[model samples]
Target: MPSLPSAASAADMNQVEYLGLCDRTAVEWETLRNYEMFSLSPDGSFPMMKASRSKAVRLADREVMMVGGGRCFRVSLSNHPTQNKLQS
Candidate 1:
């Protein structure tokens, strides 16, 4: 007989897959606007924005690393836990 799958494992897998989709979307839709950067998640769940005249890197679903004007900035997606913080 085949073994049953665990609910926790399934949930974890879903999260991983979702994140991967987001990553891929970021790579696909990545663009520069007025020296700023922007991208949309594959599923259109959210949008990531980078400051103008700056470089940005997505650290996760809710985190972004940016650099510009000789300074580094850490940006967070709205409603994220670290949204209140200026830095990561």
Candidate 2:
């Protein structure tokens, strides 16, 4: 298959198989904050964690993984509007 065009080059170029996805500026991934940031009560409707200073909750060995909705607040890094970060 043909390769994608660079972010720099115009995507208007016609390709045989695949469009050149190169030359284009790469989109970045972003994180955001949730309601859990405000309330730390184990029942704030959202769970949170601090990877740098906070410790992760211990789980049972060989136990099934916990499945539920979770949330957190993180400082927004990029110009994105949705991304955010929880300040400790």
Best-performing candidate as measured by TM-score:
1
Worst 10 residues of 2 by lDDT: 18-27
lDDT (tens digit, per residue) of candidate 1 on 37-62 = 34443443444455444545443454
Pairs clashing within candidate 1: none
State each model's C-alpha RMSD to the native. Answer: 14.4, 18.6
What are the runs in model 1 whose C-alpha is more than 4 Å off?
Answer: 1-30, 35-37, 53-64, 67-88
TM-score result, candidate 1: 0.23
Query: Worst lDDT window (10 residues) for model 1?
Result: 16-25
Q: After superposition, how far is residue 48 of candidate 1 from its true place, in Å?
A: 1.5
lDDT of 1 at 5: 75
User: What's the lDDT for all of these models?
Assistant: 0.40, 0.28
Q: What value does the lDDT take at residue 83 in candidate 1?
A: 38
